[model samples]
Target: MSEKSKNEPFGDLMKSMNQFFHEKPVKNILQSMDDFFKNPFPNSASFHVELKEKDENYVITAELPGINREQIQLDVINNYVKITVKQLNIFTTEDENQQITKKQQSFQQSTRTVPLPHHINEKKVKATYENGLLTIKVPKEKGKRISLDGNE
Candidate 1:
């Protein structure tokens, strides 16, 4: 019997329901759900990496836990080094007849690209993996100094 809502003919009841949804807590929950759906798999926003410069080469070490060497890919393109890791898991439940009743599959992948200060020879790059750590060594390209004073 309250005043009718201008936006809806369902009267004050619908207006009250709509007001409930505008509460701060409810809005925050809805916003979180919206963000999650927008990017369901927000993986590796901050992958760990370390870089060191030596006299003749550069060394890079990355921490990649619970990952196997076969699941990792490394590439030296231009003056940058790209590292990618991918893991896949499959689970299934079988009955006495060996028929899968429930099956699930999950896939995850992360990638990090690091820029080098100097040009490197990709052919001479060396990489090794041990104990969830990856180390890469890249030799710097020799530079020839040019004299500007007309001197050889």
Candidate 2:
């Protein structure tokens, strides 16, 4: 008889053998832990906007990083402006040094809608993108009454 066989009890050995063969729950728990650690942020995307009024135009700037231009959509109707950004997740697997390597990649996606303080000329709206920043210029509506007209 082997030394290990002699040292271990028969009942304990049988239980261990059963556990090794029936490992579905253990495998599920391990997989859940792996997914939890790999995805710390479930949402995976965020954004911020800055609005400024300069002379005859309202300048709106949005910060979007790690996203492609094709995944972004913009719409302006009346005084409401809507912006949408989408990003896809990419996963890669490889085997190195007898170990599995997994790499997860994701991009930014967000949407924002805001009402302009004053009406704008929709036909004259212009948008520009540079270094992951999107700048939109909307010409202010002409002859609009100022709210502080009677205050001063």
> Highest lDDT: which candidate?
1
Candidate 1 lDDT tens digits, 1-152: 33544556776677788888889999899898999997765764335889998988899999987789999999878899999888899999999999999999998778889899766678899999999999999887788998688656
Worst 10 residues of 2 by lDDT: 143-152
Q: Which has the greatest TM-score?
A: 1
Where does model 2 exceed 4 Å of error? 1-44, 92-108, 144-152
Q: How much does each candidate deviate from the true structure in C-alpha RMSD?
A: 9.2, 15.6
What are the TM-scores, per candidate, against the unseen true structure?
A: 0.66, 0.54
How well does candidate 1 match the true structure, expressed as C-alpha RMSD?
9.2
lDDT tens digits by residue: candidate 2, 18-115: 79756998778878888999786677565788888899888889998766778878899778788899877888787876464887998655788868
